[model samples]
Target: MRNAVLLPNGFVLTTDNSAGIGEKEADLVHVSDEVVAYFATRVALMEQWAAGAHPISIVLHNFSGNKNWDKYVEGIKKLFGEIAQPCPEITGSTESNMETLQSAIAVTLIGKQKTDSAEKYTWYVYGKPCVGQEVMTESDKIADLKKIWESIKSGLVESVWPVGSTGIAEECKRLGLRCELQGWDIVKSAGPATTVLLGIAKNRIEEAKLHFGKYFEEIN
Candidate 1:
């Protein structure tokens, strides 16, 4: 499915990736392991949470190596660790027989939502994103993501559509929505998907503000 598959038990299933577009050269010598895991895993989990799913497990596809595995896991843990929740079971493999020139990882989340109100939804872009360098340098990034998750849990956010290397402009086109995004660069890469599109309702805007705080942005 292009989107999450709605299951009969009120759950949803989805997957996402955080590949370096095959640009990383020589054993990922230049890329940061922690940054890769953080963005990649967060992207997958966010997609699940967007569908109102409570992530139960994560299956990681690690192409880095044994030496980098701990760092990757550490990054993933940091993502879930923000909410003070135990991370879901994680199991994955590292390439030992061969060496990849670049870093790549695919994160799959298995989750279930207890209930979905099935309300009519409105779309908006969320996050303060920029291209390049700061993907790792930013300190407040994870806390900001936590705020978005908190808003989702607060019933203010119905779902989220992650904006990957494709940037906001392409995602808006894909969703058949006009890119009314203001005060931002909509076509730049949100490296490691530092941003996402939120699905919400008009009535819950206030609640979103209360929970998301500085992380919330509107693009309709």
Candidate 2:
């Protein structure tokens, strides 16, 4: 079953989980627990962010040890700091007594949009995800991300739908959107929501370009 739930108070809550994907695969790099934690955080945050919700709290489910615990918390804080987003009240428990073979974590982001207007919008793909790699490399370009968030915060973006593990085609299908993809393939797994499906009006396209630049890919 899907992990996201919508509340009656115009609030949307989404949860995302991460397993020791890297450790299990020889082809993949063995990512640290901190990186895994950040992946979980980003996955949840992307859902909430796309829905025009301001993240108000974080609830973590940690399976790693004390060392991984601190790194996990740091990853959460680091992103908020980088984006200039207020750090939400964070609280969760670690499964210390039990021992597991691989690291795992699940994070849920709670947020509300605080508005009553119900409006439909034109959709665009924002930032292509090269699996999970681009999320890390592109995130390092702080200015680009900041601009995207600034645009979203200012209402230029009507809504957002972060691409999930199922890939862009599935995500678009989930939202009942048709695809006219270009520059990037549409059926690749985003893996923890490293990219988004952006919603805006046709008239606002130029304005969005100023913020998104190469990150924006229109789907007609």
User: Highest lDDT: which candidate?
Assistant: 2
> Taking the candidates one at a time, how many backbone clashes does each contain?
1, 1
Evaluate model 1: give its TM-score. Answer: 0.80
Off by over 4 Å in 1: 1-13, 19-31, 138-143
Cα lDDT of all candidates, in order? 0.71, 0.72
Query: Which pairs of residues clash in candidate 2, taking residues 3 or more apart in a chain or in different chains?
Result: 50-160
Instruction: Return the top candidate by TM-score.
Output: 2
Taking all chains together, each candidate's TM-score versus the true structure is 0.80, 0.85
